[model samples]
Target: MRCQNLVCGLVLLLALGTSTVVQATKPEDTAATRAQGQVLFERTCLFCHGATGQGDGPAGWFLGRYASPRPRNFTAGSFKFRSTPSGDLPTDQDLFRTITKGIPGYMPSFASLSEAARWQIVAYVKSFYPGFRTETPVPLPLVGAPTPQLAESLDRGRALYTSFECHTCHGTEGRGDGPVTQAGELKDASGLQIQAADLTRPSSFKNGASLPDLVRTLLTGLDGTPMPSYAARLSDRETDAWDLAQYLRALSAESVP
Candidate 1:
């Protein structure tokens, strides 16, 4: 009985030691991960993002000529969807979300991919820009819920729409046919012509159509685009950004069939 007990103890110790080793070698942003990501990218993303991530793949060219928005150039380091502050590098999770959800009309959702594989791709994509190595992502502050007084909130939101001069780009009726858009004056950092979102079409929102998503856009703005961050511009007492978001939501609601 004593000899049998000793063997059991030895087996338990060996099992625990193996578990520790497995935990220690868990996958991270290592060379192996990047290489696996590269392979995945070549298989899935190279058609649109390209071998160099310049958004200049053959399919990209085909799409650019016919598509309104082109594929993103990772080399530019200008991501549109993010939880981070405007002009800041997005967190790993942000990239993961973009990969999972994708842009509405332009990018296809890769949610089918394993989460680990998606993260690996994110690591590889970040490799395109050296800034990712040195910069830490700064998350934007959380937005508060709309004021309890619904009508009063909408009223304030309407006033904020005018005060913020949103009509200059989104049009007075939220049709996206504002003078700037009419003149084709809006250009992204890449000098590519871009259009203001039609506020009436909530379904077309690239980031998302949720209230929180709208508020986040108002706070963080779309980097490399004309949208400017309101986080710094709005005063602590001013709930103007939230009001604006509310107003936008109302416009979208009106357009619903």
Candidate 2:
């Protein structure tokens, strides 16, 4: 009995020591750790995720061929497959899952890295959205429903839409029949073949077909797919969800004629 107790005690001590070592090795989201991660990220992930984590590095150009969804624009707060609801920031575990499991069409799993390293990457990635990270209050827009002149604005929106290459997937008529459909190939960043949503058929939306909802989705973008939030890339006046909503409504209205 004494010998058996001695063996069990030794095993418990060894387990405790191992756990302590692992806990010590795990990275914390400190300034020093983030600094270290920055160096590592620059060396490894910068080419694809960009130095700014904007998902527009040179590698992103080629990514469209295989990835169905577009790479995430880290500047935007959108993340797909998060346990948290949309618009809310993802938890650390959520970010970890994305980094480890990899999002379809956007990122691949980096199983080679140790757990500590992935946490470090999360800290570094959050650095890209300082405003979002800090949760700064946004400036309120010119409030009120769009004016009757909104129709004219929709025409202008159409011009901007085409210029921005929105028609590539959203059809010329916003019926989801853009040029990519010619090959019958549609995909999101995760290498998943997907059907583009027809904006004209607003009723088809999983989210309610309300104008405000459309605007929020456009400004924030749906997480986990090719759809990107144009907030930073486009002028608020130009890409205002209200204007896009008007244009989309116009497009749908035109289909009736």
Candidate 3:
């Protein structure tokens, strides 16, 4: 009986020792992963996105004012071109797309980075936002040209609108009754409530309505509100902007006639 008890005690001690080793190894592995991500981000993206993803990087200011949108403030966690709804966190793949394709105003394509490096960067970036988890995969429009004709643009644009979760804050029908709408309480970095523009009435436009003007809004994003620039956010070329413009036009048209 004594010998049997001794063998069991040795087995328990071995199990405990193995568990301690595994727990010790995990944190080291995590640190190594983060370090790899830091190296890649510093070497490639820090030029435009800033050393800490502040959107005020060196090239960030030099990009000059244009009709296009700009990079996002990752610290704020407001992504302009995500498939997820506004105010929601973006998926890992969403970050990957923005990183790989590059936004028009702030970032350019990073065709040089390997797929593995891109994934690492995605992991590193997400660390900045607390409680951020990968969002569900949101699909894009299925049956339309990247740049649809004026006639089909609204139909396709609706898909883009839905795919991008514009309805989350903009309302399903663009009425500003979206899930995030809280009775004129959508504020900016400031404590002001961010107002969602009513698309049905052109007269209600605090901003004007020209293709260039709208495209610029999409690119540069309106300051002092939840509207961040989508220039680097969306994947479609000018086509994404073009199709969306058409959709907004159609919405405005409905309000008038």
How would you encode candidate 1's per-residue C-alpha lDDT over 52-123 as one tens digit per residue? 998877788766474246778899888888878888888786787778777877788888888788888988
- In candidate 3, stretches whose alpha carbon ends up further than 4 angstroms from where it belongs are 1-29, 64-70, 133-257
What Cα-based lDDT does every candidate model obtain? 0.75, 0.60, 0.58
Q: How should the candidates be ordered by lDDT, best one leading?
A: 1, 2, 3
Per-residue alpha-carbon lDDT of candidate 2 for residues 106-216, written as tens digits (9 for 90 to 100): 566665778788778877887887754575333212222332336677887677677767788788888888888546676555556766668787655433344544444
Instruction: Give each prediction's root-mean-square deviation over alpha carbons.
Output: 13.0, 18.4, 18.4
Per-residue lDDT of candidate 3, residues 1-257 (tens digit): 56755664465345423421111111222556667888898887777668888765777655533312334567777765453444556656557666765653346666467766777777777766665654444523211122434667677777777877777777877777787874655765535355476666644543335443344356556554677656565545436766886787677664321
What's the lDDT for residue 184 in model 3? 58
Per-candidate total of colliding backbone pairs:
0, 13, 8
Q: Looking at model 1, which ten-residue stretch has the lowest summed lDDT?
A: 17-26
Measured with C-alpha atoms, the lDDT of residue 62 in candidate 1 is 64
